[model samples]
Target: MKVGVVDVGSNTVRLLVASVGSGEVRSLEEGRAHLGLGEEILLHGRIRRRKLDELDAVVTEFARIARKHRVRELETVVTAPGRQGGESERLLEVLRRATDGPVRVVSAENEGRLAYTGAVARTSVGPGVVAVCDVGGGSTEIVVGTALLGPAWVRSVDIGSLRLTASLLHGNPPTRTEVESARASIREAFSGIAPPAPELALATGGSARAIARIVGGAYDAE
Candidate 1:
C-alpha cells in the first residue's frame, strides 16, 4: 500500500510517500517547504493570516503531489507549529481545507516516539538501549529505547536552533557574547534532565544535519 504523511513543523512542512509491505517500507517521494513557522510564532506568538494562507497553499500542493503519486491514504500531522502557537483552530481549519482530512497536532511524546522509531529503523543497532535526538525549529526531542521495545523514555525540550538563533544569535556569525549566551540557554534548557544511557545514539532533523556537516563525520566529546 502507498501511504502519504504530511508533517507541519516549525521550520518546514514536509511530505513523505512510501510503499509498505512485508514489514518493510520503501520511500517513493519526499517534499519539503521552508515556511519558517517558528520564526512567525516567535515574532507574533501565532501564525498570522498571511502565513496561514501560505501554509494552506503549501499543504494543498503537497496533497496534490501525493495523489499524483497514487497514495491511497494521506495523513497530516502538526508539530510545534501547532502545539506551541496560539489560535490552533485557525491553523487546523486552514490545513483541513488543503488536505480535506483531519489534521492532528501530535503530542511531544508521540513526536519523540516517531523520531526514535524512524531513526532506529534505518540504522544497525544492538539490542541495548538506543537514543534518538531530533532537533526541530522550535523544540528538541530525546527518545531512549530498544528497537524491539520502542521508546522507553521521551523528553521534549522547548528550545531549538531556530528559537536559539532568533532569540540570541544576532550577527551573521554570532559574536562571542552571543555564542556564550546561546550556550548558557542550552545548558539551562537541558539542566535537571537525565536520560538513560544508550549504547548508540542517532540524530535527525535539519539542525543536526547542518552541525554534522560542520563537525565532519560523527559527533563526540572531542
Candidate 2:
C-alpha cells in the first residue's frame, strides 16, 4: 500500500508520500509551502483573504503532485488551527479540489494520539509508562500514562509556538519579558494536572530540534 501524510497547519501545508514496507522506496515524495495559516486566525482572531489565496495555491500544488504519482490512496490530515469548525470547513474544501485521493480532517484529540503514537514508535516500546509531548503550531499534546495514550489521562493545551510568538513576542529574538510571560503561561496551564515531567527523551518538533541545534554541543552531533 501507498500512504501519504498531510499536515495542513496554521503556518504551512505539508505532504509526504511513501510506499509501504518497501526499502527501495526510501525517500517519500514530499512538499511544503508556507501559508502562514495561523497568522490571522489564531493570531488575530480571523482569517484574511490574502492568506487564503496563498493556501489555495499550496493545496493546488500538492494535489497536482498526488495525481501525478497515481497514488493508490492519499490521506490528508489537518491539525490545531485547522480544527476550528467553520475555518476547517473552508480549508478542507480547497484541499478536496486539490487532491485526487481521499482527504480526511482529523480531530484534535485524534491528531494528538497520532502524534503520541508516532513519538512512542520511535522510542523503545513497552518497558513501562512513557510520556509523549507533541508541541505544535497551535496546540500541545501531553500524553502521560503507562500503557500508551488512552483518552482519560491524555490532555491537550491550545498554546503553541506560533500562538505564543504571535501573542507574547514581538522582537526578532524575543524579549525577556515575552520569554518569562510565556513560561508563566505554560506553568499556569499545567497547574493541577501535574504530568510526569518528560524524561531526557526525544523532543520531536522543530521547536525542540531548534533548541537542540542552538544548544549545539552534545545534541548537534547526532
Candidate 3:
C-alpha cells in the first residue's frame, strides 16, 4: 500500500509517501516545511494566528504533493503542538482541513514508541536491547527495549535543539555563556530520567542525522 504520513511537529510539517508491503518498504517522496509552531507556543503559551495560517498553507501544499504521488492512504500525526494546553483542537482542525484525512494526536509515550520501532526496524539485530533517541523541535524521546519485543522504557524530555535555541540563544551566534546555559538546562531536564543499557544505540531526527554525517562522514543506523 502507498501511504502518505504527515507529521505535524512543533518546528516543521513533514510528509513521507512510501510503499509498504509484506516485508519491505520503499520511499516514494519526502518533504518538509519549517513552521516554527513550537517557538510561538513556548513563548506565548499558545499558537499564534500567524503560525496557524502558515501551517495551513504548508499542509495544503503537502496534501497536494501526496495526491500527486497517488497515495492510497493519508494519515496525519500531530506531536507536541497537539499536546499543548488549549491548542490541540485548533491544530487538529487545521490539519484535517488541509489533508482531508484522519488526523490524530499521539501522546509523548506513543511518539517514543513509534520512533523506537522505526529505528529498530532499520537495524540488523536480534533479541537484544536497542536504544532509540529522537530529538525533535519540542521534545526529545529516548526509548530502550528488546528489538523483537518492544520498548521497555520510554522517556520524553522537554528539551530539544529548537526549544533550547529559541529559549536561550538570542544572538546570531550564541556566546559561551549562552551555550553553557542551554547545556545546563538540558542536563537538568534529563536529570530525572534513567534508561536501560542497550546493545545498539540508534539516533533519529534531523539533528542526529546531520551530526552523524559530519562526524562519521556518513549516516549509520548501528
Candidate 4:
C-alpha cells in the first residue's frame, strides 16, 4: 500500500509518500516547508494568523502531491506546537481541511519513541544500549534502548535550535555573550536528565540532517 505521512512540526511541515508492504518501505516522494511555527509561538504564545495561512498552503500542496502519487492512506502527525499552549484547534482544523484526513497531536513521549524507532531502524546499530537524539525546533528528545528491545528510557527537554535562537541569540551574528548565554541555558536544561551510556548514538530530525550534510560524511557518535 502507498501511504502519505505529513508531520506538522514546530519549525517545518514535512511530507513523505511511501510504498509499504511486506515489512518493506520505499520512499516515493518527500517535501518540506519551513513555517517556523515555533518562532511564532515563542514570540506570541500562539501561532499567528499569517503563519497558519502559510501552513495551510503547504499542507494543501503536500496533499496534492500525495494524490498525484495515488497514495491509499494519508496520516498527519503534529508535534511540539500541538503540545504547546496555542491555537492548535484552529491550526488542526486547517490541516484537516487541507488533507481531508485525521490529524493527530502526539505527546512528547510518543514523539520520542517514534523518533527513536525511526532512527534505530535506519542505522547499523546492533543489540545494545543505543541512544537516539531527535532535536526539533521546540524540543529535544533523547531515548536510550537496546536495539532488540526498543526504548527503555526517554527524556524530552524543552530546548532546541529554534527555541534557543529566539530566546538568546538576538544579534545577526550572535555575539559571544549571546552564544554563551544560549549554551548556559541548554546546559541548565539538560542538567537534571541523565541518559545511560550507549554503544552507539544516532541523531535524527531536520537539524541533524543539516549537520550531516555540512560534515560531509557518515554520522558517528564520536
Candidate 3 local lDDT, residue 189 = 94
Residue pairs that clash (backbone atoms under 3 angstroms), model 4: none
Residue 181 local lDDT, model 4: 95
* Cα RMSD, model 2: 3.7
Strongest candidate by lDDT: 1
Residues 106-131 of candidate 2 have per-residue lDDT tens digits of: 77678767766667665665756666
TM-score of every candidate relative to the true structure: 0.96, 0.84, 0.92, 0.95
Models sorted by lDDT, best on top: 1, 4, 3, 2
lDDT computed for candidate 3:
0.87
Ranking by TM-score: 1, 4, 3, 2
Query: What lDDT would each prediction earn against the true structure?
Result: 0.92, 0.68, 0.87, 0.90
Candidate 3 lDDT over 18-67, as tens digits, reads 99999888999999998788888889888877888999998898899999
Write one digit per residue (lDDT tens) for candidate 1, span 33-89. Answer: 999999899989999999998998999999999999888899999999888898988
Candidate 4 on 1-222: residue-level lDDT in tens? 999999988888999999999988999999998888888999999888888889889999999999899999999999999888476899889989999998999899999999998888877887789999999999999999987999999999988889999999999999999999998998999997889999888888878989988996465546
Candidate 1 backbone clash number: 0
Backbone Cα, N, C clashes tallied per candidate: 0, 2, 0, 0
lDDT of candidate 2 at residue 55, scale 0 to 100? 71
Please state the error at residue 31 of candidate 3 in Å.
Answer: 1.6
